[model samples]
Target: MSDAPEDLDAWVVTLADTLGLGADEHPIGLLLDLTRDAAHGVTRPAGPLTTYLVGLAVAQGMTVEDAAARTRATIAEWKTEPSEPA
Candidate 1:
C-alpha cells in the first residue's frame, strides 16, 4: 500500500522545526548532515514530535526495512565528502 499523506506531512513539519528551518527543507537531509558533521556520535533527547513521526510512518504501511533503507541512504550521503568544483 502507498504511504499515508498525513504521516508524511507531519514528519516533514516536525523535522523542519527540529532543525529550526522551514518545512520546505528536507529533514532527513538535515539530520544526515548533522550526524556527519558532528565530531563524535551524538545522541540527544528525541523530540516527541519525531517519535510520533516514526510511529506514524510504521502505521502508514511503511515497512521497517523501507524506513531503514531511506535512513541509511541519507547517512551515506552525509558520509561522502563533497567534491570541490574543478
Candidate 2:
C-alpha cells in the first residue's frame, strides 16, 4: 500500500517491480477492473479473493485475460443472497 493514497499507481508499479512481476508486463488495469467488478457484484471483501483465484487460474494454464473474461461472465450471472432476511 502507498503512504500517500494519491500515489497508488506509482506504488503499484514499484510493488510489481519489487515482486518481480515487472510493471511493464503486469496486467494491472485488467486485474483491477476485474477486482472492482467482484467487489461490487459479490461483496467488498470478495475483490482480493477473486484476484487471488485469478492468479491460481493463471498458474493452472489459463491466461489471465481468459480467466478475467470468465470471471466477469460469472459475476454477471451471480445472484447473491442478502446478509439477512430482507
Measured by lDDT, the strongest candidate is 2
> Taking the tens digit of each residue's C-alpha lDDT, what string does model 2 give over 1-86?
45664486787788878888775666778988989999999889999999999999997999998999999888887745434434
| Candidate 2 structure, TM-score to reference | 0.70
Give the per-residue Cα lDDT of candidate 1 at 69: 60
Stretches of candidate 1 off by over 4 Å are 1-52, 81-86
Clashes of each: 0, 0
List per-prediction Cα lDDT, in the order shown: 0.51, 0.84
**Where does the lowest 10-residue lDDT sum fall in candidate 1?**
38-47
User: What's the distance in Å from true for residue 60, model 1?
Assistant: 1.4
Q: How far does residue 65 in candidate 1 sit from its true spot (Å)?
A: 1.1
